[model samples]
Target: MYTTKIGLAPAIHDSFIASEPLGHLLQSSKWQEIKDNWNSEIIGFFDDDQLVASVSILIRPLPLGFTMLYLPRGIAMDYENTALLDYIFEALKKYGKSQKAIFIKFDPAIQNLPENEKVIQKLKNLGAKWMGLTAEMHDTIQPRFNAVVYKADFDEEKFNKKTRQALRKARNSHTIVKFGRDELLDDFSEMIQKTEHRKGISLRNRDYFEKLVDTYQADANITMVYLDLKALLIEAQTMFDQAQKAFETKETTNEKKIKQLENACSKAKKDLSVLTDLVQANGDIVAVSSALTVNFGTHTEHLYAGTDTDYQKYYTAYLAWFESIQYMFDRGAETVNMGGLENSLLETDGLLKFKKNFNPKIEEYVGEFDIPVSRLLYPIVNKLYMMRKTRI
Candidate 1:
């Protein structure tokens, strides 16, 4: 027999969730503090004194003394365990009634594969209203599709030619990747603002970034990519001098070799001049890109990232992403989630195109579900919510 316990200890709850296959950081007790505006609780299911299931629920107060319970990423439990699922859902429904909740909302991290159809049907059998499989970005509370890189070890060779070339160019241009906590937040925020202006979409602000860094503590990091113009200028000047000398010496008697030398000298001279002017206009070093990552269990999430459009040719974003992934892998992560992607999988989508270079596996998640507590109020609230989301 299973018994439900509310207000489970944080460490105990986290340990149990981390052991589950569907464990996620959003379901962590710490995440509750991040979403402090919502009244939250950690509920655990114990079978013979052994914790077998857990969910961190956020309570949103509604009009007329009603409430809505949301389980972000859903409960961490074995979906194959029908008995446990039935018990947990029954307990949740009772709990919702006690709180005067209109409904309970959840979107599990499980993939929408053929094998998982039975699990979806099981959820519906338990009275969950399955929000249809959606592909658009705004149709659900969380994205239905995600780009994830799953590997036991990091390998640059696995990346496609374009990605490898971009990494090489960033390295050749003297790009420096640095990792830190709040110290790098300013540069990260600046790059994010630039990205927002370029893409015309507002992402998280500085305060939210700061909160993430602070809340996650050692589990989170900000990786910044910088270009040392002074170093590049010196290197370019040296290359130009060498090319000019090689051309003048006429060391290669072949006409083809002579032409190659001439072109090399001309290109080197142009690069040297450009670097010199850039060094004069800007400082010795400038930030070009940055990424924010959070580590939980064996998974690392590349949550937010930004790059300066002016340095697009330098490919600093690629370097930042690569180094961040390396950092997470070294820290014992088996998977690095590259965050959400549009489900349409359009070839013209720049985000999808960029992530595809890394050869990520696209995860199509089972969409949201709503378990009605108040039959009449559930329909009204859900309809209003959908209308509001459509407008946004």
Candidate 2:
């Protein structure tokens, strides 16, 4: 009643994935182009002549000629269809055996909802080992928790007060957001490098970033936020002048108003001084923040982003991120994924705190699963993989 097809063409594979509700950019065939280090294949399951399911698998060579098969956020199919699920696993096992794959690992993009308990159990029933619900960032290959902003009429007024204030400050400071492809890559890369050094974590290099833009083509964008120091300086000076005049002309015996005027004058003076110094050191304009995003199907993902710490007060990152989201939506993307977050969802986490400003709904996935092909080698290979992962 069912048949399997290997090496499905990119367009055909992408079409099937785009048609599914759980479709993700990771499952797109173009992602294989980004993960060039891994040998990849697109496998499709069909009922007669109609394609029912598909997964883009990445194969990595392991020790002693064994291989590991990974389907990142994959198996773009209806999980409720029991028969299709069984047949697909069986087909994958047979294919894995042919390639001496130790096991096939996958972490579907399905959210961990109450109704999905049956799907998890069904995976176990098929002899796939469920990696427990991990709450840490490094506990799994892909993050188990993601922050997402679902599509609606875009409204800035709906944002929290702090976020709105930040956006206002960014605008008042004369920050400009520009979106492009390869042209902005250099600025984007520099910001990411600064972030890497500040956070003490390694991220993708320039070459990898280049590959992403090149492979994804029109769907990918690099957004850069630039600050016009000259304009900011003028604005700060104007504010300082107004505040100074207000303080001097205050006929009111209200000490509170006098104090407010004094504070405003002092803050404006400080900002003006800082902007002058920055202009002297950098230039009239400087790139303060940058982000990379990719749109696929109905969703857009904010992949990697960074900000120059020196210009932190300018809040350019906020403008960059918000503009990128707007840009993606303008291009017809329905959902914008803010990417991964730590599972704990603690307010103390700086990344979570920053992403929460946008008020995203946190999605917890069903974690990873391993379908062992060579039961004898799976345990050993998995152990080694885990150790290597931790070191990285």
Model 1, 116-207: lDDT tens per residue?
99999999999999998986988988888988888743589988888999999999888888999899999999999999999999888999
Per-model TM against the reference: 0.92, 0.93
What tens-digit string does per-residue lDDT give for candidate 2 at 159-261?
9899999999988878888989888888889999999999999998899999999999999999999998888888878988898888888898888988888
Which sections of candidate 2 miss by over 4 Å? 239-268, 387-392
For model 2, give the 10-residue run with minimal summed lDDT: 149-158
In model 2, how large is the Cα lDDT of residue 23?
Answer: 91
